[model samples]
Target: MVLTAPSPKIRRSATKVALVVGSVLNLINQGAAILGPADISWVHVALNFFVPFCVSSYSAARN
Candidate 1:
């Protein structure tokens, strides 16, 4: 079996996802400082999960 490299599009998508996740986490941390952990909402949970899920799915499907 031959090993291949990921395509540019996939790389870009993954990087973008990483950036977005970082930014979101930063906001969450900031909010938590003021509001505490119990303030997490369903929308935040869904975005934290499904955003990464879709990015991973896109990369895997392309490969």
Candidate 2:
């Protein structure tokens, strides 16, 4: 069997894409809270920061 390694450029590009997507989702979640009912704001807050932080940390560690 042969093993292939990913190039550094590819790794960096993937990381950047992940970070951008996470950031966009985070922003959307936060924005949603502005128009949503007060009771649902907490949920948005949690999703906005918690999920992104977890994904970002994992991506950073991988790099």
Candidate 3:
């Protein structure tokens, strides 16, 4: 099946949710690196937020 882009409202909502959830997840998953001198995995950090945003937007679009 083909997929279309989600609406602006859905994208905005998904972004809000992603930011909140992703921040919590990042803090939990990489607190040491974030709060210390250790190197942080930038890719992993982006995915953590992006995955949630995609999931939210997809679900909204499906509905």
Q: Model-by-model lDDT, in order?
A: 0.59, 0.55, 0.86
Better of 2 and 3 by lDDT: 3
Against the true structure, whose TM-score is highest?
A: 3
Which residue runs does candidate 3 get wrong by more than 4 Å? 1-4
Per-residue lDDT of model 2, residues 1-63, tens digit only: 012124455446556765676568756755655566534456655565556555655555565
Evaluate model 2: give its TM-score.
0.40
TM-score, one value per model: 0.43, 0.40, 0.86
Q: Write the per-residue lDDT of candidate 3 for residues 1-63, one digit (tens) a residue.
A: 025445678879999999999999899888999999988989889988999998888888777
By lDDT, is 1 or 2 better? 1
RMSD of each: 6.6, 7.4, 1.9
Alpha carbon deviation, residue 43, candidate 3 (Å): 0.5
TM-score, candidate 3, is 0.86
